[model samples]
Target: MPFTIDNTILLFSLLLFIGVFTTKFSARFGLPSLVFFIAVGMVLSKFIYYDNAALTQLFGIMALIVILFEGGLQTKWRNVREVMVPSLSLATLGVVLTTLVIGVSAKFILDVSWLEGMLFGAIVGSTDAAAVFAVLGNKNIKQRLTSTLEVESGTNDPMAVFLTVSFIQLIQSPNANIFTLILSFFWQMGLGLALGLLLGKIAVWCINKINLDSSGLYPVLAMAFAIFTYSSTSLLKGSGLLAVYMMALWVGNSDLTFRHSIFRFNEGFAWMMQILMFILLGLLVFPAELVQITWQGIALSVLLMFVARPIGVFISTMLMKFTAKEKALISWAGLRGAVPIVLATYPLLAGMENGHLFFNVVFFVVLSSALIQGATISPLAHALGLSQGKKSVVPHTLELVSMGKTNHEIVEVHVDEHSGADGKELRQLKMPQDSLVNAIIREQKMITPRGNTRLQAGDTLYVLARKGQNEEIKALFHQQVTEQDSANV
Candidate 1:
């Protein structure tokens, strides 16, 4: 077949399908699905014409926005509430610290100038939410640990982006004052925070009130709102990525119509974005350049995964009560994905020092991080004894799409013979503040639940929880804690 435009489409279709299937066996080899995507891009780079930096940068940004928004949507707020300070600190201060350590290390190891090294460090600093989320979707973790990792990855991007852009500007204008840059940092983050919260609330309010006739339209509406959040915040000199993520988080947690459908749609959307992004990024590179940076790239990758990430996590959680084992797992969970490669384009676009080399190095570092860190998360979690094994999610779920804007979820949970739920009265389950057992099904018969009613071993629970309380509601039907619940991730 002649490699025409039609052939190109067929090629991509085949690769993407193959890529999706390949992830099924990714854990066996201890490699993330992203490595294959990049490898595919490198293999095809010789056959394709993908030398447009500007276009690649544009698409990468778009993909990242969607990816982060999807990260927000999948996250459950209630799970993270208790660990808010640790999560936020890791996202903000932890990112800055990691960037600095990596920048200095890269400068000396790579023999690069300070600005160039800082730019490289900043680009690769934040843990990629796409990688973490994709990996953890298959992971069996405790709820708090899962929430902490998700929130850190989701929120840290703005800081990394800020540092990347700031370093680029410094290189361009050698006379720029350090104090001014510091001020700009705070200004951008502050405005982004305020606007993100405001826009999130506004979007949620509008989404709940404007009951659309078609359920599918709700996802479309939510996507449009996400785009608006990003664009508007960026135009106002704030962190658009942060704003978009915050907005999605609020919408996901709110009493919006068609909430379940939107979540499912966005999850699939996130995977597609990851595919497009890694493939495009792969096409942008020359495989030969990667060889030049191999040893150096591997060294930097090791520093990032083992030294910088652990130090950042430890410092960020200093005031908290985390076990040493949990901290170790958190450190290992830092998987770098396409975000660094995407940020690599910033230096290239800015015509900064060793821009091409930086891009290639960042690319290799990401591949290393994903291959080394991504693959090891499960094993490390197990070895550390921090792996809580999987929680009991409501199997055979049947969610009722917002009969109309209400902040409640209809969840169906099975109470197996081993579950703690077997003999507990409704009030003794200690469900979240507003959650209730609306009904029960036992022996193929439905029964309306009352507060004093006792549950049975074979009962199926019909629960109504306030929105974003999926974690809280699941606890009611979970089996009693046992020592041997091995993690499957």
Candidate 2:
């Protein structure tokens, strides 16, 4: 068949369908589904010979915006806040340390120039959230450890991007001073954070005020807002990725109409984004080129997986008070993914010598990380005593909300020991009309509370109530004991 638009569409559809199927199959075998997605893309690229490299790159960029935004939305302030200092320090200083260590090691081991070594280090320094989240989700692990990893993955991208671009520019202009580089780094990250906050707030205000009849369209609008935030921030010489991610995190945790539906949509969207990013990255590779560089690539991948990562983790987490097991697990969990490959593209785009070699090397590193690190994550977690016991099977909760409707209600209720509802069946609580307990978190265990489930003291209940009735519901639940009732008692 001729390579036309129709043919391209059919090919993409087939790949996507097969990709989903392969992901399911991979999961059944206890392998990382992402590896399968990339494998599928590689197979297809060899067979079909798709020629739209530019389009693939564009799609990869778009996918990043979605992935980062979804990540942001899913992030909770409470979880991040608890580990803010350490997480931030790791993302910023730890990334710098990792890059320097790897760069210096690469210079000595691989005989590359300092700038080239730094580029290699920067490209591989940041952990990929897509890989980390996919592995960590639904796994039994301590909340603090999981949160620390999640927060690190989500926040560390900008630093990697900064270092990568900085080295790229330094290589291009060998005379650039250290002071100029430091100032530029500060400016980019600072501006990105500011723009993200501003844009996120505006988006939230717009979402709350706009009256849209179709609830399904709200997610699309939110996505547009996210993309716009990213683009505007990038245009202003800021880290658009950071801005969009921070904005999404803020908005996701905020009080917005159709909040549940938006989150649900974004979750699926993010997964799709991850799949597409990996596939595009896979397609960007030339199998012939990879074969030629295989040995060197393998060596660097090994150095990164074993030497660079462990040393960086050890030094960074030293004196941080994490248990020995926790520290070991943290060291093992630095799985690389699409970010390095994407960052590698910067050098290629800059027409730098050895750019293709760098890309292939980074690709091999990611593949190895996914294979070794991803495959053994659960086992390592278990060995390190970080695994949560056998998982409990709980039915998932589906939350649907109407958008642009101020009549909807969001309520928070804290369970107390003396409350009459404690230890009583959910059905017996006589909760206000049109109210449902969406989530009940007790001792850090998240439960989808059912009608027959008994409420426990110290549980945090997220109750979704009907609009205009929240005040009445709160009054009913928070009723004080009357003097007459005491006298009768």
Number of the top lDDT candidate: 1
For model 1, which pairs clash? none
Candidate 2 local Cα displacement, residue 472, angstroms: 14
* Runs of candidate 1 exceeding 4 Å displacement: 1-5, 394-409, 414-418, 422-489
Residue 335, model 2: Cα distance from true site in angstroms: 1.4
lDDT by residue for model 2 over 1-489, one digit each (tens)?
798999989977877787678777767776777798888778767866654545665676788788778878877788888877667777887788879878887676656899899989999999987887788777777778887888888778899998998898899999989898888788889998898888899989988788787888888999999999988988888888888878987897676777767878988988877877787777777677778777777777787777777777777777687877887788788778877878888888788897877887888889888988888878888877788775433222233454254465566667665456667788877677778788888899998888898887777777776655555655555562232245558
What does the lDDT read for residue 259 in candidate 1? 67
Query: Which lDDT value does model 2 have at 127?
Result: 90
- Cα lDDT for residue 245, model 2? 79
TM-score of each: 0.85, 0.85
* Reference-based lDDT, each prediction: 0.81, 0.78
Q: Can you write out model 1's per-residue Cα lDDT over 448-489, one digit (the tens) per residue?
A: 898888988778887777666765566544534231133211
